[model samples]
Structures are given as C-alpha cells and as structure tokens.
Target chain A: DAGVTQSPTHLIKTRGQQVTLRCSPKSGHDTVSWYQQALGQGPQFIFQYYEEEERQRGNFPDRFSGHQFPNYSSELNVNALLLGDSALYLCASSTELAAGELFFGEGSRLTVL
Target chain B: AQSVAQPEDQVNVAEGNPLTVKCTYSVSGNPYLFWYVQYPNRGLQFLLKYITGDNLVKGSYGFEAEFNKSQTSFHLKKPSALVSDSALYFCAVSPTLAGGNTGKLIFGQGTTLQVKP
Candidate 1:
C-alpha cells in the first residue's frame, strides 16, 4: 500500500506571501497531522485533522491553518510567511484505533525568502 | 505542558559496538513515548513506542527502548551498530487529555547518531 504522500516537495516564497502544501494520507487512515521541522531541530506540531475538523492544535499562531477533505487528504496553508517560517513541513497519518503511532510523508520543503 | 528532551546533539560509535541514545520526557499524566529515526532528506520513521505494556519495547530494525518511569527516561539501545544506522533520532511524547490520547506529539531537539565503520 502507498504510504503518506505530499505535494510540492520543494517550494520557495517571499515574505508576506502565502503557501499551501498538500498531503494524501496513507490508505485506511483517517487522521492527518501537520508538523514543521526547522533546520537542525525536530519537528513541531502544527495541527491535526480528523473527520474534516481540527481535533488538536499546537502552539502555532493563526497564520497557520489546515484542511482535511472527506478522502482524508490534507492541505496546510501558511499565511504572511516570515523568513523564520522556512522549514520542512511534514504530514503524518494515523488512525484513532492506532492512537500513538504515525506514518509520515517525505515532507514539503518551504523556503520563505 | 508536555515536552521531550534528547540531551545529546550527536553520538558516535564504531561499527559492531553497542549504542544508546538517551531521552527523557515530561507530561501531566501517563506519557506515551516514541522514538523515530530520520535519514538525510527523509521524514521521521517510527522506531518504537512505550504505551502501557513492557518496559523493554523492541521495534523496527534492531532498536529497543527501555522505559524507566522513576527516571522519566526512555533510552534507545542496540546491541550492535551498523554504519547504515547513522541518522537523526528523535524522542517524542504524546500528550493525553481527559484520559484520551490527543495524538499530538511533542518532539525533542533530536540527536544525530554516527556509526563509524
């Protein structure tokens, strides 16, 4: 079975711009969570979506938002991107039945110049 | 607030030697700990986790982690290290709210493991 997949593997944007990254959860999974990994650091949680509604969120500001479609695919949208927003955005998928473990995608590299 | 700490920035070990990567976590109640490995230009891969069962949990590859409740630590261990084992390791904790797993992970800064041949 295909694992989690993300689109726009690499992209660049200037400050004040907005970017949207996409993800398709692994087959048989219903939850999608987004994470941001800065250079030389581990990933920080952004938010998680289940049933097309946000179930949990991290410390990120309102500028970061996400959407989950009926098919369980997700999209992460970052508005007014700052230079510090540049990082690798990872998408992970899991099921409520398997609560703790997650399967991640290759991630989309965003460079806010 | 839930958090994870991987004190070492990097660890080096010779091939065929044993290796251990240390991790400690802090959370309100029972913590769900996890270990993930990331290779260059790759996403984090789940290694193992400590939910509610055995203190010693064996996972993918040759990785095993020991959970010490008193110490609040979960250290990953391997009897023999391979050169290919070199990668960035992350320790994470899943926060529980209202007695349910939120599925949100708080990750450590990560430790780079170098297994020299």
Candidate 2:
C-alpha cells in the first residue's frame, strides 16, 4: 500500500506571501495531521483534520490553517509567511482519531526568504 | 500539557556496540509514548510505541524501547549498532485528553545518534 505522500517536496516563498502544501494520507487512512519541524528540532504539532473539519489544533497562530477533503487529502496553508516559517512540513496519517501509530510522508520543505 | 525531553543532544557509539538514546516524558494519566527516527531531509519514521502491556516493545530495524513507568522514561536500544543506524531520534508523548484520545504528539528537541565505523 502507498504510504503518506506530500507535494512540493521543496518550496520557496517570500515574506508576506502565502503558501499551500498538500498531503495525501496513507491508503485506507482517514485522519490527517500536520507538523512543523525546525532545524535541529523535533516536529511540533500544527493541527489535525478529521471529517473535513479541524478537530484539534496546536499553539500555532491564525496564519496557519488546514483543510481536509472528502478523499482524506489535506492542505496546510500558511499566510503572511515569515523568515522563521522556513521548516519541514510533515503530514501524518492515522487510521483513527484516537491514539494510534502514525505514518508520515517525506514532508514538504518550506523556505521562506 | 504533555511533553518530552531528550537529555543528550548527541550520542556517539562505535559500530557493533550497543546504543541507547535516552528520553523522559511528562504527562498525566496513562501516557502513550513513542519513538521515531528521522534521516536527513526526510520525515519522521515510527519506530515503536508503548501504550500498555509489556514494558519492552520491539520495532522495525531491530530497535527496541523499554517503557519505565516509575521513571517516566522510554529509552531506545539496539544491540549491535551499524553505521546506517546513525540518524536523528525523537521521543514523543500522547496526552490523554478529557474529551478523548486525539493522538496528538508532543515531541522532544531530538537527539542525534552517530554510529561510527
């Protein structure tokens, strides 16, 4: 089965610009969660999308938003990007919303200049 | 809030020697702990998790982690480390929410494991 997949393996954006990163959950999975991993740091939870609605969110600002489609694919949108927004965006998929093992994609590397 | 701490920023070990990456967690109720490995420019790969039952859980790549409830620590171990075992290791904890289990993970700063030849 195909694992989690993410688009725009690498992306470059300017400050004040908006960027969207896409993700397709693993086969047979429905829940999608986004995470941000900064250099030399572990990933920080961004938010989770279930049933086409945001179910859980982390401490991120309003600039960070996400959407889940009926097909279980997800998109993470970052508005007014800052230089500090440069990081690896990881998308994880799980079979359920409860405690379960997560399968991750290769991730989209966002470089905000 | 749930959190994890990786005490060592880096760990050096020779090939053929056993390796251990330390991790400690803080959370209320039953803590669901996990270990993930990340290669350069890659996503985090699930190694193992400790939900309940056996304290020792074995995972892919011959990796094993011991869950110590008393110490609130889960250390990853490998018996004969290889050069390819070098990678960034992260420990995470899933907080049991009052609403329900969200499976949201709180990760540590991460530790770099350098297995030398």
**TM-scores, one per candidate:** 0.98, 0.96
Please count the clashing residue pairs in each candidate, in the order shown: 0, 0
Report the Cα lDDT for candidate 2.
0.92
Clashes of 1: 0
Query: After TM-score superposition, what is the CA distance of residue A78 in candidate 1 from its true location, in Å?
Result: 0.8
Poorly placed runs, candidate 2 (over 4 Å): none
What digit string (tens of lDDT, one per residue) describes model 1 on residues B1-117?
A: 567899999999999999999999888788789999999999889999998888999999999999999999999999999999999999999977786888988999999999999
User: Which portions of model 1 miss their true places by more than 4 Å?
Assistant: none
Chain B alone, TM-score of each model?
A: 0.97, 0.96
Question: For model 1, what is the alpha-carbon lDDT of residue B98?
Answer: 88
Please provide, for model 2 over B1-117, each residue's C-alpha lDDT reduced to its tens digit, 9 standing for 90 to 100: 568999999999999999999999988988788999999877889999888999999999999999999999999999999999999999999887676666899999999999999
Give the local distance difference test score of model 1.
0.94
